[model samples]
Target: MQLLEAKLHKIDRHNYRSYSSMRGEYTFVDFDFFIDTVQADPYAPASRVRARRKWALTDLAWLKDQSQDYQRAARDFIARQFADLSQQENGIQIDRPGQVILDRTAVVFDEEGIELRFRINLPADDRKIIAKKAMNLMTFTMPKIIRRSTIARELPIEEMKRHCEAVEDQVALRKQLEENNLLAFVADGSVLPRLAGNVDLPMANAIPFECPAELAIELDAPHKGKIRGMGVPKGITMIVGGGFHGKSTLLNAIESSVYDHIPGDGREYIVTDESATKIRAEDGRCVHNVDLSPYISNLPMGKDTAAFSTQDASGSTSQASWLQESLEAGAKALLIDEDTSASNFMIRDERMQALISKKDEPITPLVDRIALLRDQLDISVLLVMGGSGDYLDVADTVIQMHNYQALDVTAKAKEVIATHPTRRTSEGSEILPLPRTRQLNRAALKTMLEDGKFRIQVKNKTTLRFGRELIDLQALEQIADSSQLYTVGWLWFQLAQGKGWEKQPSKAFENMLNDDWFRTMPHYGDLAKPRAIDVMAVLNRMRKADFK
Candidate 1:
């Protein structure tokens, strides 16, 4: 406290070097505070003090000792503390201090001992020093807030602990996917619907999901012990049922299961492979140097699809490009819904096949090659179909959603398929060709750079305003938080750094995984770790990306 107080009288607004000199660590009895970021102008809104509070492992062990869920809840609990501590606007009793801030990922447990980022405004006297305000804040006000918010024995941590435990249990369940030969699992009692269109909260009257005995598989999760759920095995699995029968709802749940949820969020135990990607037709999305020959070929004008590049792609072309790019970025499983899929890309009925005549048609529908996706490429596909029965012939397992219940009808569907054959010709049996690695021209990126600095601004959770380009991520459903978006934007800037990023984008992710930036997740605050595929999904959509 004295150290922070000593620098109070020495702040020089004009030089700003006086403020830089004051940036250092100050220790209290229970925790140490390291001033991480110092604002140049103390009066500026962006000009603020960023510090981290580190507590002993013993002090935080109660939060993390039990399960991953408890640790996550503990983080949420601590973050809420700052909010709860806010008495009023411009609170904290300090002169001109801003609201206490904590990033979302700050609560997630890493190897580091429990630490949380904090930001508060330091008062300045005429752009110089406000020694008395600084002294009162550091020595009296700030300590009281920290003591109450963090170390108060009366505070409720148990509820948060249990919540975190439950959340982490879901994560643990997802990690066991490959070992169980399953791509996804939805626990018998999970709720699958949100309250409304915009509200993410689970509906009060939503039906609870129940797994059929035939499809139910039991697993010993770390926290939940023995749990039984519907395990969608590795291969082509189709969810086919009547409209408003929870087919898309179930599929939506499974697609989002790629991210772990909070406790009591109703879909907590539903787990999918972390590498699972939700693919849909995105018309007008940019496609850069992607090989669309497998899904599409022989354009009307004799256009090339081997290295497809389109500034404004059609529905069929965009979905094809999205799939090829996902494969390039190493997607293991695809979650697709017919409602959002391009009709032409999904299937070509026998009547349409007769009308178009195979020779005249440039496109080979997904129904023709979906089986090959599994058989040859080892990629699992989970498709939700309401109008198409053609998928049944190619489906390895059929799940019919009835009144929000999953009924395994593989045998029944097979019988129906045998009785009434569509006789759809298989188009391509050859495996999807490997994605060609791109060599990014650094000059293109450098030309986009402003003032010799890389530019990336996240407009929202689903939009990245990168330089002059707007990378739309509305269809990238798995991005769970705004912090993840912020991290991805910075990550793109990081990828643009140094050399060799152009040669192999996938390899860049692999090498970056070993980097301290990837391991530690630096610069961007509290980030949910995103897959390389998610990053590539955004980049592949960038119009300014120069790929060779």
Candidate 2:
């Protein structure tokens, strides 16, 4: 503390140049603090102080003591503390907790110690520096704030840590889903509904989720001991019920289960396959030479479906291309809701089949090939439907959501299908081609870069402005946080660099996943760990993406 105070006291108040001189290390109780960055101008919101704290090896051993899930929980717990401390500080530049993001680091059990990185507001009067005040902030105020919020015994740190552990435990259970043949799970007592149409927080007076005894399964987790939940098996599964009967609400929870949530967020225990993606119709979205022959072929003008490209695609064609793109990205399970899906792309009923001859129709619809996706491609489909009974014949499990309760009606649905069989003729190509590597138009994409750095800008939660391209992510329902978008932006920046990106997009993504800087950056802490496919979605949607 004396060392920091002395350095601050040595600086001249009016000489703002002294602010940069204050960048160094200071020793405090139980931790070593290093000032990694200092803001040149104190009055500017951009002006900031970045620091890192290293704790004792033994103190950290407990955090990384358990499995990967435990480590992720502990890290999340520490990040929560960082946010709380920043909010309580009341410091001039350091009060915003939003800037404190723990790195989205992989949970490893062999860690020797834990280090937390945070940014503080370096106080100043306009452009002039306040040396003594700065000393008080660094030496006295922030230390106490960090201790009380982070290391002190007063806060419910243990309970918060337990919350992260529970969420991670749920995430761990999802890893065994493929081997167990389960697509998704919702724990008993989980609150599924949101507060309202606009709000995302758990709804007041919402119904708690209870697994029907018929489909309830028990799994042993590391932290939560034994967990009993409703398990939705693989293959084509449907959630059907009347309006506002929790059909969309139930699918909403399942799709969002891809990322771990905060403790007490109500959906914390919900788990879905990591590769599960919500499929939707994206009208006017750009498509680049994707093979859509499986769903649509023999166009009216004789346009080729096998290497299809479109600048402004219709609802059905856009949905078909998006499905093929998702499959190319290695989707294991697809989450689809009828409300967001294209009517024609989902089903061609008997009436429609009879009305239009096979030669007259170019579209095959998803129903015919959905079974093939499960049986041949080993990909599962979870669809939310209220209007269609045509899907019952292909459904392995049908869950009826009535007033927020799930009823396993697979047998009843099958019986209905047997008694009233649909004479709808199936239409689809036999083979679904896998996605191949795409060659980048490096010159056009490089135009978006600035002075060797890709100018990545985030417009909002629903949009990402990458260079001149506006990638629409409104259809990507699983991307819940803004940070995930930022990570995607960075991934595009890497892709735009155009060096060593000529290989398969998946391979390039795997290499980026292993990069040291990519793995440990502060941006990673804010990330939800999107799959390579999600990253590819951004690239595929880029309007400026000139692929060879």
Candidate 3:
């Protein structure tokens, strides 16, 4: 084992620090016997004892130590000799041999932020008999222990090292994420288009802009080694995972960023975006209460008397309806959720566009309205989603939120491209054209919140100040009759994440259509779990309410 360790240290980049140890046996007889047994039957003996090429599984295992394993040998054999023959054939020496090692790495699953342990693999075929034999035995041991016990699942350490290397390689092929920029969070607006559905950045506008690739944050922050920020990519970045996996808390951290942070949010996404709005679901819909029954067909002309307040009105637009108009009036970015009534990619597309298609159309659709504002008006939209659609097909980037973490599908797409070079694109495409227009109004978004305040700092000195309107939390309590309380809460939470949520939740549904931001939210894709259902229904209601 020490000699093998010595050999590995001699190999560049795959070496673990070595210290001389006298614990291992110096004799070759027992070691050879152990080796011969493993070299034959890795799991069971092929023949009785003393038979040529026959060995006992027990004899080989009894010789196994706490560290060395059997599966290690077969894996090393597979890696160095069998793993990357195609790479070698293609002139890429990505694999040496399927070598086994004790190297380790911790990988974070999506947004739930679960840290899964993985073994690193080395490419060398030459390995000590002790280590190789142990790993093969583990392949059997792992599945059993996982189902019944809390034991750590043993992975081919060499495989982990190789896979981690492969992960970097896959990330390298993508142009948007830099090597140094990777394994961390990115908050740059330029990266926004990827999440925001390939929407172009607003140039020469009221809002300052930075390219996604140009913006840099770190994965490790404050007391750790420097790296780019964790991903909180723009467009509607969603955090999804199983229960107790931290989805609502993920939203909480984002909400923290919108206001003055005392401890500040630990989430990399909010820290990076220099956000525009954070909205909660409790706020009712923001929309114009024009008699929709005339053009909107089924919608009732329910006039507000004691129910809807005229005091805090942003004019005739109700929370849901005004969003469509505000976005048309020009709001740079908007984030809402499944809490609205939006659903399915193709269905939403047809209905949403119908409503936004010219005034007086009987069937109204939010998608068409949003598109009009995005293409014709230049407002970007960001709303949450939970199912499939034309949205996914048209999405510039799809962020799969398995856990609490966020990974741009653009990253995943690049991975598929790397393994299959024959595949279309292995890298991020060129920057799309966007009209550099429209200044971000942080004050407007905050005024839509409870005691929301705005502070802007540029070039180290000049500061712009904006004040927010006090939200009547009591009104939230009073408006139990409204359909958008959750929608309001959701939008508020989004704004609080440092981006700033300006419109009421209902407005988000109306605003979402015909806009770029609507294109980015992660989709649950028709799954009806508790967390996803609570969120998706809210978004759908707000969306459907517009056409109704």
Candidates 2 and 3 compared by TM-score, better number: 2
List model 2 lDDT by residue over 1-548, tens digit each.
67777777787466675777766777786556666567666553333333333445224445544655556566556556656665655562232112111225322123334555455667677667787777777777776655554443545756866766776677678876877789988889999998876577788888899988889998767778778899999999999988988999999888878767676778877888978888888999889888888888899788998888998988998888888888877788888999988899999998888999888988888888888898888889999999989888789999999889999998899889889988888787676555555665555566766643555656465787776566787877766656567777776666666753364675577567652534444422234345677777777888767765
Note the Cα lDDT for every prediction shown.
0.72, 0.72, 0.29
Task: Encode model 1's per-residue lDDT on 1-548: one tens digit a residue.
Answer: 66776677555343433566666788766656666566666664322232344455226645545643445456666666654664552423211111111125543345555555555566675667566775676677666666665653645666655656666677678878999899999998898998887667788988888899998998777667988889999999999888888998898888877766766778888889978988899888888888888888889898898988988999999988888788878888989999999999999988887788887887899998888889878999999998989999889999999988889999999899889988767776466656676677655665565533556666466887776766788887766665566666666666656665477777676555442443445522345455677877877777888887
Per candidate, the number of residue pairs that clash is 6, 6, 155
In model 2, what are the clashing residue pairs, if there are any?
Answer: 93-121, 94-121, 102-525, 103-525, 104-524, 104-525
The 10-residue segment of model 3 with minimum total lDDT is: 45-54
Task: List model 3 lDDT by residue over 1-548, tens digit each.
Answer: 34433433454332221211211222221121111111122222211101011123112222123122222222232233222322322211212321112111111112211111212122222332233423332223322322221111333344433433322322222223333432123333211111121221222222211223423344432222244434443432333334543334334333323211111112223331222333333334332232322113322364542122223332122333333333333344444444433232113343444555433323333443444434554444444455423243223344543443444455554565556443111111122223221222333444444443342111110111112322233211111112123233333335444553334443343354222221232211111011121222232222212211
What TM-score quantifies how close candidate 2 is to the native fold? 0.87
Q: How accurate is candidate 3 locally (lDDT)?
A: 0.29
Those runs of model 2 whose alpha carbons end farther than 4 Å from true positions after fitting are 1-48, 90-112, 123-135, 149-157, 437-447, 451-453, 495-501, 514-528
Highest-TM-score candidate: 2
